[model samples]
Each structure stands twice: as structure tokens, then as C-alpha cells.
Target chain A: METKIKEIIKQVKKGDQSAFEDVVTFYQNKVYQICFRVIGNAHEAEDLAQETFIRAYVNIHSFDDKRKFSTWLYRIATNISIDRIRKKKPDYFLDAEVKGTDGLDMYSQLPAEQLLPEEEVESLELQSYIQQEIMQLPTKYRSVIALRFVDELSLAEISEILSIPVGTVKTRIHRGREALRKRLRRV
Target chain B: MSCNKQFINLMHKYLDGELTRTDENLLRSHLHSCQSCQKHFHELKRTTTLLKSSSELQPSSNFTEKVMASLPKEKKRVGYMRWFKAHPVITAAAIFFIFMFSSVFSAWDQDSQLSVSKDKNLIIQEDTVIVPEGVTVDGDLVVKNGNLKIDGSVNGNVVIINGEHLMASAGEISGEIEQVNQVFEWMWYHIKDITKNLFAFTNK
Candidate 1:
């Protein structure tokens, strides 16, 4: 895996755009997952993911070979997500669906009807409920929950990706989950 | 770690299915005995289960294509080989730089040439001579039976022969400013007479 990443980096340096596409394909799902969890919306997550790739493409030369590619990607995504939050400053955490470029509500395109009708109904209900409850979490805990559980990144991976201590990751995850449980019970 | 904090951290790991068998067993043993941790662990599990079972929203199938479409075209990068083969924009820029370089050097060359020619007894018959300002010329200035005035300034020796030379009061020749009147000198008369006699002798 290390050898392959190095080769991809080399190809990127050689101006091989296709090699960059391969890097995008390999990390897209993980990147999208992180974006979605951080922002808690599909459309914004997709936009952020696209922007992340574009940023990576423009700045590929700065990538350090000694570091993990995944870590570098997450760092880019995390910074972008943080910037979005700082800009939006929604009332109820980052879950508010602002109008998109086309002037249509971004979250309105969710897959509410695609799931088996009964599950679809339940899923929509649960999604909204989860969003509200997750929003109630302290931002730090909220971030941990989003990065760890929603994104499915390992505690160690989250620590490395966020540049926080491993102990901090574990503590945040625990506290975040605890706070989330309280929010859900209240609902 | 104490069973209290260990229970909470392990509960998070267990909910995420990241706990190993040994840790899971230890956590379960602790939870069974500790009612508070047990209650917290159970509730944490239930809520996380709810989140996991929540709608797994993948972006539209066209998502990647849409992103690709939103991006500007890949900009068919010209490889080194093709870059040299002739691109209109590149060619234009190259031509512009060449013109600029030549003009800059030509202007410098012309200025130097004009200063040198001014010192020589050669008169600039045409307005083609371009003497850039602030340059010094060291020689004599003799505009024989013509005008003589320095346009701007002269710092070094100013020697001119036969033509008008303008030295604005601002013009200061650091070297001696000597304007010898050479309407007809002894050397010129002797040389002319000898040349005329030589022609007569050659005819004989």
C-alpha cells in the first residue's frame, strides 16, 4: 500500500491527471463519509468532497511522501469542513439545510422514498431525530461522534487525521456518545 | 483505568464494534456488576444502533459525473513534445518576448553607437543618430563655418569637427573645453599644396 501510494504521488508529480483520478476514486467514499458526518447533509457533503479533491489536485506538490495519504486527505477535508461551519453558523448546529446554488433546499433531495416504504418512513423520521439529537452535542463532542461513528474512522485514525492525541480521541468519543445518548432519550 | 471510565470508553468501542473479544468480555463483566455503567452502556448502544440503522444516504449515481462535469475540462495538458510543436498562445508570448528583447538591446546599442560617432570627426548628417541623455563624450567640438550649441549637457571632453554643436549652459564638459578655429590651418594648407603638386608631377 505504501509503495502504491508513493507511485501514485510520483505519477501526480509527473502531471498524470488520470493518476489523480485514481487517487480520487480510492478515497472518495471515505472523504464523502467524513464530509457528510461533519456537515450532516448529503448535498453539502458532496460539494465539500468535490472541493476537497480540487484542492488536493491543485496542491498535490505539497504532499509529503513520509506522511500517510489518507491522513493528508482528511486534513484537507477537515479544514474545509471547519471553514464551512465557520461561515454558515447555523442556529441548530451545522444541520440546517441552506439553499444551494440553484436556489433549491439542499437536503430536500435525500433518499426518503427509495427505502422500502415502511423503512423509508422510519428512516426519514430517524434521520431528522438523529440530526436534532446530534446537534445538541457540544461541538467538540459532536465532531468526535461525526468523525468516529458516522465516518467509521478508527480512534487512532481520527487522532492522526485531526492531529489530536489518541487519549483525547477516546475521551471525546466516550463523552460524545454519552451526550448523544442523553439527547436521544430526551427525544 | 478504573472500571467507570473504562466502561464508558469500552462502551463506545463496543457500540462501534471495535472492541476485541477480551475487552468486550471485561466490559461486559464490569457492566453486569455496575448498574450505572450498565444503564449508560445500554442506552449508548441503543442510540448508536439507531444512527447506524438510519438511512444510509449515498449521493446520486451521477454524483461523480456531476462533480467531473462541474470541474473545468482537464485542460488537455501539452506535454513537452507537443508544447514545442506550436501552440498559438505560446507562440504569441514567445514572439512578444523576442520583439521586446531585440528592441531593448537595439536601443542600448544605438545609444552607445551615437555617443562614439559624436566623438569622431564624422558629422551626423541625418537625424538617425540617437544619443541617449546623461552619456559623456570626450573630444573636440568644431562646427566649421556652421552652428555650435549643446542641446542638454556634456560631462566629459566635447570634440566636434565641422558642423553645429549645441551646448546648453547646463552642459558641462569636465575635460578642457577647447574650440579650435580650424577654418584653414597650416597643416591643412601644407597637405593640400603637396597633394596638388603630387597630382601635377604624376600628370608629367
Candidate 2:
């Protein structure tokens, strides 16, 4: 699969533009998860992830083919998602890029229930707790933590994805972990 | 008892699995003795666990389709002949330098012979250039039409075009290694090389 992606990358670099769709499809889930984990939203993350691939497509020339392709893609995804967070209002997730109301919206189709089960409510609370805490983190720490936790990537890989020093990556993960500890202990 | 603030970073590193054996022992001793530190480490550990366990959001089924539809048209990569025809002066200079560098500096060997640009502290066995174990190569190494087996270390970028590169178990590379296994990759490699040279010249 890695070699195949490399070949596709070569083709894309050679101006076989249709080949980029394969790249997009191959990476969409991962790219979306990275954005979703960071931004804490489904719809905006999809937009940002789409924007990530599009940016990657347009700026593919800047990417060196030697390094891991996912590193470059993750870098683009991280930067785009963080930029959206920085530019918009602090709580953009509440009113963010929730695009068209496709009739197939999953939540709308679910049967209405008077209440979620107690365990479901507890898990939902924890989910919101986790989301709120993640959103509260500074962007630098947010991106690093998301990359670290979502993918369980090594600190070195995080360094490559963020283009920061490994030492810096370590420091951020340490600080980010400590920050989360301080916040979540309250819960 | 009271916890020293210094062991705070150690607690996080312990969770991250980055502690060296010695540091691990030290932190373990500290944790064994420190009550607050233990509680703090537990909280930190749980935070990461919960973060990992957080709900994952799935993209709409049409996500890839939407992204694919919205991409801007590719500028379209031009073939070398088209590029050369478009930039005649550059093409001429590039051709001149190609011959100049080939003949004067690192010439491509005819008859499918091996050509490696740097041989500083290199051991050659047939067509393979081996950076011996414990030896460090200080600069970029480009091998053409041959194989490179790095068992030691390279402090610079390694480019293998029309060749194979292998990393022995003990090998380490500080910079990236680019192995071009395809003809298209080879073309783009040269294009990038020529463009870099041209850009450097134009900047000057």
C-alpha cells in the first residue's frame, strides 16, 4: 500500500490529475479523523479535511517526495484545522461549517426517544467533557495531542507532521498531558 | 507526603514511555516514595486514556466525493521537452551544465557501470557502495545504476536513482533517503535538480 501510494504520488506529480482522487480517497478517513479529533466537530472537520486534500493537491509541488506522504498530508490537515480555529470565533464548533442539509442526516433519521439510557448519558457526558477540554487547549498543544492520541503516533512522527523539533514535540506532549491532567482531575 | 515539582515532567515522560532505564529507575523510586506524585501520574494517565477513548466522528459518506469535486484544476505537469522548448535559455544552460557536471565532476558511467558521487571512507564491493558500520558519511551521496547498502550512518541526504538502497539493521540516517525506483521518478528527480540549480543561479 505504501509503495502503491508512492507510485500514485509519482503519477500525480507528473500531472496525472485524476490520480489525485485515489490519494484523496485513501487519505480521507485518516485526514478527517485528524481534523475531527482536533476541531471536535464532524461537519467542519469534513470541510477542513476536504480543504486539506485540496490544498495538498494544489500545493503538491512544495511536498518533497522523499519523506512520508502522510506526514505532509497531516501537516496540511493540522495547519488548516488550526487556522480555522484561530480565525473564527472561539466556539466555532457551535456554528461552524455545517453545510448542506442532506436529507440523509444520520441523527435526524434516528427514532426519537424520551431519554438516553443512564450509561449512554454518562458516556455522552464524558465525551463532551473530553471534547470541551480538548477544545480548551491552546492550538499548539491541541494539534500535537490530537496527532499523538488519535493516531498514537510516535513523538518523532509528531515532530515530522508538525515540522517541529523532536524535543519541542516532547515538551508539548508533556505540557499537553499535564494540562489535561489538571483539567480532567476536576471531572 | 509532599511532591517535588521537578518530578512532574518525569511523570509525564513515564506515561509517554520515553524514560530511559536509568531515568525510569529514578522516577520509579521517586514514585514509590511520593504520594502526591503517584496521584498526579494516575490523573495524567487517565487523561490520556480518556482522550484516546473519546468518541470518533465519522465523516459523511459523501466526504471523499465532495472533496474530489471541489479540487482546482491541476496546472498540468509539462514534459521535459515541453519545458525545454518553453525555456530555451534555461534549457541551454541546463544542458551545458548537465554535460559540464557529467564530464567534469560526476560523470554517468557508460555500459551500465556504477557511479557514486562521494567515496569518502566508502568501501566498494562490486556495484554496491557500503557505508561501513561505525563510519559516518558527512555529505550527500548519490548512487546511479548501482546499489547502496548503508550499515553505518549518513549525516546527509542519500539519493539513489536507477539503483537500489538497503538499510542494514544497525544503519542510521540523519537526513532523508530518496530511492527512485521508477522512470517517472527519475525524470522528476532531474527536473527538480535542474530547477534547483536554475533557481540558485537566477537568485544570484
Candidate 3:
């Protein structure tokens, strides 16, 4: 898959429009998923996803081949998501820690175990519940959680995509998990 | 390390199987006796599991098509403006050279040829040359540093240097006619004459 994507990117660099369409097809879902998870809206996510590809197309020449193409695409998608979120909610702070109902930092909350069985029906409900709580996390924590868990990206990969240190990525993931655990415990 | 702090710090790494053998043993021993730490570990594990299990949202059916449609057209070739933008120094240099060449060429003196008239009616005064009526100059007529008054026919080219040529209603010039009256025009003419004479002497 990596080799295929690299070829597609090379073709795109050579001004092959059809190869660009292939790229858009390959990354559309993943990019849309990232945007949707970060922005938490279907319409806005679609718009941002489209905008991300548009930006990628326009600036495709700046892409470095030494790095993973997915990482580059994720960077564009995540930055666009962050920008759109910031634009929509001017009062939201990325650096500030989100607090739960107990007046403690959400990330500092204790982790909890799954109290229900592994029934498929209950699992779906739990999944939905977890996603809602994930959405409620602070923007920074939500982004890391989405990239870490939803996208199943490695900490180093997340670091590269977000342009942060690996230690910071691990810390954000830990905090994001704790926040979700605390929120789920209430339910 | 203290058991509680150690457990708290290593809980994530432990679930992720990133702990070393010694730390893993220590955490396991600690979890056996510590219910709070064990519960926290289970919860964190469950949280990550649920997060991983969440389904990725699929975009609309036409999502890729829409994205492709929205993409701006690829700039396949370097346009003149884009080349100019990229090579600003070269563009500026070219423009400067063109301007300089045009200015120099425009300022260069234009040469005027002279021929004396053999006609009897041609009158040459101190500062004015006049061709009276019913007279025809058979050769090229050139008036230098003076005005020319023509009332008859001239069979050759008529040129005036540092002066004006006034032609009456009945006057006729059979060849090309020109006037050079500017100060720079005179300088240009003298420079051109000197260069020609020098070239001719060099050839000789």
C-alpha cells in the first residue's frame, strides 16, 4: 500500500490528473474520518475534507518523498481540522486542560474497567458512548485520541503528524484515555 | 520507587506491553495487592479498547468525486507571468537593457547628406539658402546651420541641419526631406561624421 501510494504521489508530481484522482480516492475516507472526528460534524467535516484535498492538490509539489505520504496527508487533514475548530469556536483553548464535573482535570481522572459483557449490542452502545465522551475532550486531547485510537497511529507517527514530541504524544494519549474513562464511568 | 506513583506512571505502559521485565514484575505484584491500581488499569484498558473498536465514518457516496471536482486545476506549465515572478532579477535586467538600448538609439544622431545646386537661380546668402521661382536645382540640396526658403523645384533630396526648411505653396522637393534642429541632434551629427572619417582613414 505504501509503495502504491508513493507511485500515485510520484505520478501526481508529474502532472498526471488521473493519478491525483486515485490519491483522492485512497485518502478520502481516512481524511474525512479525521476531519469528522476532530470537528464532530458531518457537513463541516465533508467541507474540510474537500478543502484538505484541494489544498493538497495545490501544494503537492511541496510534499517530501522521504516521509510517509499518509503522514503528510494526515498533517494536512489534522491542521485543517484544528483550524476549522478554532475558527468555529473562538472561545475554545487548545492549550488549556478540560475539566470534568468533579472539578478536576479530565485527563487526571482515574481509568475504569468495562463493566458490561462483550455482547455485540452493548458493545455498539458502549462504542457510541465512548465516541461522545471522546468528542467532549479538549481539542488537544481529542485530536491525539482520535489519531491514536481511532486511526490507530503509532505515537511516533502521531508526533510526526502533529509536529510534536513523542513524549508529548504519549502524554496526550494517556490524558485522553483517562478523560474518556472518567466520562464513561459516569454513564 | 513508591508503589502508588510507580503504578500510576506505568499503568499505560503496562497495558501497552511496553514495560521492561523488572517493571512488569513490580507492577504485577503491586496490582495483586492494590485494588485501586488494578481497577484503574482495567478502566484504561477498556477505554482504549472501546476507542479502537469505534467504526470509521464513511464519507458520502460521491465524496471522492466531489473532492476531485473541487480540486483546483493543476498548473502543468510555467506561464510567462510565473516565469517572470520566479526570475525577477532577470526580468528586471531585460527591461533595463531594453530601455537603455531604446534611449541610446533614439538619442543617436541621424546623418543628413548635402549636394550643391547647379541651377543659376539658386541663391546662397550668408545665413539663408533660397531657391527662387522658375528655378530648378539639379542636385541634392542641403542647408547647414541656416534656414532654407524654397519656392521652386529641387531635383534631389532636401535636408536641413540645426535649422528649419520653409516651403512655399509652389515649392517641390523630388526626394526625401528631413530636419534636425535639436542641440543633441547637432552633436550626434558631428560624432557620426568624426566616426565615419576615422573609419575611412583607418581603411585607407
Q: Pick the candidate with the highest lDDT.
A: 2
lDDT score of residue A20 within candidate 3: 87
Between candidates 1 and 2, which one is better according to DockQ? 2
Query: Which model scores highest in DockQ?
Result: 3
DockQ of each: 0.30, 0.39, 0.55
10 residues in a row with least lDDT, candidate 2 chain B: B103-112
lDDT of 2 by residue, B111-160 (tens): 36777888888889998889898898888888878889998898899999
User: Interface RMSD values for the candidates, listed in order?
Assistant: 3.0, 2.4, 2.0
DockQ ranking, best first: 3, 2, 1
Candidates' chain A TM-scores: 0.72, 0.73, 0.79
Please give, for residues B1-204, the per-residue lDDT of candidate 1 as tens digits.
Answer: 235576777877886567899999998788788888877877887877766553365656666665555544445553553465657788778887688556644543443222333533233434222223554444433233334445344555544433334444355556644442343442353345467789999999
Our model 1 lands, by Cα RMSD against the true structure, at: 15.8
Across all candidates, what is each one's fraction of true contacts kept? 0.31, 0.80, 0.84
Model 1: residue B201 alpha-carbon error in angstroms: 53
